[model samples]
Target chain A: MKHNFGAGPGILPQEVLKQAAAGVLDFNGIGLSILEISHRSPEFEGVLNEAVKLVKEELGVPEGYSVLFLQGGASTQFAMVPYNLLPEGGKAAYVESGVWANKALKEAKYFGDVEVIATAKDKNFTYIPKDFTVPADAAYLHLTSNNTIYGTQLQEFPASPIPVVCDMSSDIFSRKVNVADFGLIYAGAQKNMGPAGTTLVIVKDELLGKADRKIPSMFNYQAQIDGGSMYNTPPVFAIYVSMLTLRWLKAKGGVEAIQKENEEKARVLYEEIDRNPLFKGVCVPEDRSHMNVCFLVENPEHEKPFLKFAEERGIEGIKGHRSAGGFRASIYNALPITSVYVLVEAMQEFAEKNK
Target chain B: MKHNFGAGPGILPQEVLKQAAAGVLDFNGIGLSILEISHRSPEFEGVLNEAVKLVKEELGVPEGYSVLFLQGGASTQFAMVPYNLLPEGGKAAYVESGVWANKALKEAKYFGDVEVIATAKDKNFTYIPKDFTVPADAAYLHLTSNNTIYGTQLQEFPASPIPVVCDMSSDIFSRKVNVADFGLIYAGAQKNMGPAGTTLVIVKDELLGKADRKIPSMFNYQAQIDGGSMYNTPPVFAIYVSMLTLRWLKAKGGVEAIQKENEEKARVLYEEIDRNPLFKGVCVPEDRSHMNVCFLVENPEHEKPFLKFAEERGIEGIKGHRSAGGFRASIYNALPITSVYVLVEAMQEFAEKNK
Candidate 1:
């Protein structure tokens, strides 16, 4: 069996993929592809409305929350959230965890006063900063739930005096989180959900309408909530596939069961990296990402041969980002335990051959 | 036999959809869903490279013109164009044709001196404004190639001393045009390309580093163009499906042949509406939209019955926008000639029964 470990457009459930393949040509035998249907029609409305409800029920979102399926991925929400909530001269505190965290913070600066409360920049973002107090006067405290590139994760969120906004693009639905803990949560539907193009935004209704500026209708929370995410043509096929993936998540016992599987997968790979003298995990042990495990060899010479060996053995996407070179294995919610076993076995074999 | 006439995210060619469905599950038998593949990988890089090449070849874009497949719809570019090119105090001339035109103008007002050179509001936008000169000092003269809601199109683009920036969301690739004539052209992918979530931006390479302020990374044209649209996680599946559609466009004799077919399809439907006394076209004949043909019933009492009759005959998505409150037959690129025939036949039966 082939092992896939690419990040963020990462692994998806096999059953979800199968159902998505079938639905593209004929959705429930409607004689029209899902891509061809009108978003306003009852057929598509049913799909969208159910997906919204599932997000609420599965995450235990409190009542009066508005779930939006938007375009431009999590990157768009970096600007949209601030545009909708930041009044003129308003300030929001942002924690810089990784590349995405820094990008989000930069976008917010365009609208209002944005304060960087804490940053892991000194350590090359290898770990999440801790014990930082959020400003009480800030509108919201923003954090990255998981960083895919540097293999860092915020293990437990710190208490915030203000509302919290999270960019949970990488680790959303991988673990059970109290959705009510934050005022706003946004995720791109790529890693744990379905595909790119669709972003899932869950916002508390009360946090909206504070923006004094004239927010673009497309970026406005009220526009999306009132229009039911169909204010304009939505990313139809991506959303349909996401609905299927959500169903697969439910069928497999949701976040609780998946978290156990995810933990075990990470354990096997991390243990192999730790035991093998030739390889070293990049991130601090306390902050290694459960989703993406970044590692490197002691000698640069072993990197190319190791990558080729892994590829020959049906392992793919082992290369790391150019900025932080080495290797990465992305074990998302849908990655099976068997794939992780294959990766671990390959690492063991490589160590034996080198010795 | 099924006909889908939903405006955007509307009908796509069946062959393209079928191939896309197969790829969604296991992209070329790579054992991974296309959604999970990394954009940086050679596999996805091939997809992007080929897609850009096809767009350039099929659209007849001259050398030095860059093509970018970005996230967010054309609406995002309304602000991005001004943010990137409009120097702090620069002025841009805009033609107010319809809703989208006005929206773009309003967004630009936030940045610089935005001049509304002409407006079709005097004629209720049923016809395109004529006899207006674009200012020489303006950064760019902006226009909407086709008004999706008003059912009007610019048969001939306005001559301008400055570069032309167009929002070609509804009617791109419907006809052959000189790509070098415009400074920049952008379109949301849903209407005629594939699905929502991906926006196509084609701009001259020389049009860079003009904005005085530091633009956000996602909105920065140079950052995206330099990164090859992979500066962040792109809308993968929407783009993959677009590649398939673009491939189909190439195999079916490119945009030139499709344009002929599109014109014929629009002619058939419009002729039938003109001949029938029970129906009257909404826009003036000189300014009718070949993409969206909007028309009203001769008598208000017959509207409900005709709509019901069309629904019963398996003719769908012909209902007009809430503001118009009539029927609009959207004859996009992938809409079959037979579907237009189906709509024409339905209109004939409704007229005979109620006339």
Candidate 2:
């Protein structure tokens, strides 16, 4: 069997995928396919509420936070954040790290003034910006927790009096986090959750309804929370699959256990890259992402050959994103540490042959 | 087997559901579940393009129209319509037919002035408003083709000088339309298409980017079209199921054939409701929906007994919406004539025993 390393729509726990597949065929002994069931039905209502409860329990979410399963990915969240928080004549702070961070800042521009607190773009986004201060009067501070493309992650977080917003699209549920430390956290479910259709949002209740602009009902967190994310027909199948994965995570000892396993997977891959004569890790050591480990061949001429070598040995989607063109092996929470060892073996064989 | 007749998330063809369920397990012979694959991959890109092509071909969509599979539901489209087409200081006329039409108007109010040209609420939304003149200066005349809650439908569409926008959430793909006549058409994919999670949007290319306000990237039609609906990771499972359903429709002789069968089903059911001594049709006869067939027991006391009887015979979700309570059997595109016959038989038996 091949190992998958594609970013965003990354790996899922095998058992969760199987259960989700079975659910699509027949949900909870119901003769109808999950895809064909009514969202307003009592069966689906239970599924929705249970999924929300699982996220809250797993995250150890403090009181007064609304957990919602919304559609439209983190990219949509980029614009929606400002639309609901950055009112007219207001200013928000954004940390420009990767391409996604820049995109978020660009969309935020339409709603209000965006202050560039820090940016790592000057160095091809190879490292996270460390020394920067968020404006005291800013509405909220926005940052991407992990830069998927460039293999960089924020090693140090800035403490701000203003509400903090984070796009944890690539790194959510992989580790233990203080849920109350941020005002809002958003993640597209494709990465570590289950699939691509659902998006997770955990927001502090008091921080909403303060925008000066008229927000669309779907984009308004207050509206969604009031409606229990059923203001309109939700992405039910996606949410159902997510619920299954959340259950799997709980069965495997939650985020703290997953975090330890994820660290070992990253350590093995990063160690192999450092030891191999023909390869080197892409990002600075201090800021490397455990979820997505990116590396490159020492000699540019060896890049194609090394990629081919990895591909022939049952590895897929190991090719790096075009913007950052070396190689990326996304070892997400569900991807086992043994796959990392296999990938490391491939790299060592390639290095020996080339030498 | 029980036949489903829920309003929003209605029935889908059994074969389509089976194939879609299989897709959740394995896609295009690939071991990876469709949910586990990357949206940017060639496999999914083909699926998205083919789905769009099938929609255009099936609907006979005009050359300048753009088809987009978006996340969020038609409720999102309600606000997005005005944000993309209705400029600041401009007005748009609306035919307030039922609950959905009024909701559309409520969202549009946030962007510009909304003119309710006519409303059917005077009669508790039991009939379509026949005499209404859309203003020539209005940005667009918006209407909901089928009213799910109140069982009313617009039989006679107004020929307006202004542009026309339609919310075809419940009726899309069930009948052929002159695609070029309307500037935009939006539908939540749960009814006639496939499942929830994806919303289909068909907009005339030239009608976009004319709004005065800065549109959010996710809601902006032009940006979404340019991105080929990959502005962010799409609802892959939803779009894939919709594609399968669209293909099934084409295989079964497209919308013309489906509409013919739909008419016969409605005729058969409406005839039973009229001929039976204990039952009566709900909406005004002329504007009764061919898709959703609504009826009521002549004696209100008979309602509970008939519903319980139907339930015992494996007919679920036949109860009317809470707002208009009698009975609503939604015979959407995928529901069969045989199912309608079964429902008719149930009604006749109830009438025989009750009388």
Candidate 3:
């Protein structure tokens, strides 16, 4: 079996894939493919409802928040967040942790004044900037919870006076976060949740309708909330697969239990990276992401050979991003501990040969 | 043997569904689920490239046009069209043919001045408004090619001095269109193309970057074209299924062949509707939609029983929209003429029982 370590559109539980495939043929034994049913049909309404309920239960989401399974990925949310929250001429604070954060801030600039409270760009985003001040005058403070490109994560959320809009696209549901702490949380489903089409948004109800901008119906969170996420023809198949994935997550003891497994997966893999004489971790020890572990070979020449060596042993998508030329084994929530062990073994064997 | 008449997320070709299911489990022998693979991966890039190429080939898109597979459906395009084409303080002329066209024009108001040059609302959208003049000063004239809810379609497109933007959500590839006649044509894939998550946009490349407003990257057609519709992680599974459906279409002799089949399907169903003493067509004869055939019971009491009668024969989703208050058989591109025969047979049986 191939061990997938792709970052974003990463690994999913095998059972989820099985069920999703089954649904594509005949959904819930209804003699209809899930892709063929109307969004307004009771069958699909049930799927969407159950998915939302699972999200609430899995995250222990407090009331007064709306959970939406919307089309477009986190990239859409980058603009939508500001469109709904930032008023004309209002300033929004941003903490640039990595490339994704930089993109988010750039989108926010189109809507209003943007204040870069902290940035790690000077050091090529190797570490998450910790000493950042969130201005109360700003409409909201945006943060990237996990950096997929550089393998950096905010270990602790910064306490902010204003509402916090966090992009947790890479690490959502891999660990627990108090739902009450943030005004808005959006994540593309490709990472820990499900697939690439749908985005999961948990927005504080009171945080909307304050921007005073003429928001389009699709981009308006309030409109989506009012319509129960069926404001228009939603990404039906994407939502269905996401619902199945979430069901799998729920069956496996939810986020809390998955967190322990994810931590162990990252720990064992990172431990091997440090212990191996030929390998080295990329990010600072304190900020290295549990979701994506970035590392490199001591001798740059070993990179190509090590990648091929890992691929031979059925390891896939371990090659790092182009911006950061190294290996990034994204051990997302669905990645089994066995896959990590296999990668570690491959690394150890490769180091032995190289030395 | 289910005859899916659902108005989107409508029926897909059975073969396409099977292929999509297989891809969900293991895409192209890659041993990784399509949902789990990276969108940037060569495998997925191939799928996306083929999808674009198929669209260009099927639609006979010209050199100046770009085919985009975007998320957020037609509703998002309602805003994006105006955001990209209509400049601030400019006016967009709209032919308010149906509810969808009305909604599209409403969204345009958020960006600039809107002129409702023609509307068939007085007749409850039972006919397409034909006598509308396109103002030369208007940025663009928007029209809905097929009205799904009302079962009305523009049999002939209006001659426009300005660029014409059309929403073909319900009837995109059901027939052939002169691509050069329109500036932009968009369709939610759930109808004639593939499934719900992705939308197909064929836009004139020269028409973009004309609006003097700050269009967000996700909504900006220029940015999407620049990124090759990979401005962000696209709806991968949706696009994959769409490509498969398009491939199926091409193998069936492309749009020209499908259009003939669609014409036959509409003709047989409408003939049965008109001949049956208990049923009556909803829209004006010349304006009836080929994609969605809406009709009503002559005696109002027959409506529920007819729906139940159809359902018993394994005919699903034939229930008309609530606003229309009748029955609608959405014979989209994927629907076989045999399914139309079944529905017609059911109608004949129902009328015989009533008589």
The candidate that wins on TM-score is 3
- Candidate 1 regions exceeding 4 Å error are A84-91, A112-114
Give the distance in Å from residue B62's predicted Cα in candidate 2 to where it truly belongs.
1.2
What DockQ number belongs to candidate 2?
0.76
Deviation (Å) of B258 in candidate 1 = 1.8
**For model 1, how does the per-residue alpha-carbon lDDT over B64-121 read when each residue is reduced to its tens digit?**
8889999768877888888877888899999999888998998888778899999998
lDDT of 1 at B236: 82
Q: Calculate DockQ per candidate and list them.
A: 0.64, 0.76, 0.90
Count clashing residue pairs in model 2. Answer: 0
Ranking by DockQ: 3, 2, 1
Clashing residue pairs in candidate 3 (N, C-alpha, C atoms within 3 angstroms) = none
Q: What is the TM-score of chain B alone in each candidate?
A: 0.98, 0.99, 0.99
Candidate 3 Cα errors over 4 Å, as ranges: none
- Comparing 1 with 2 on lDDT, the higher-scoring candidate is 2
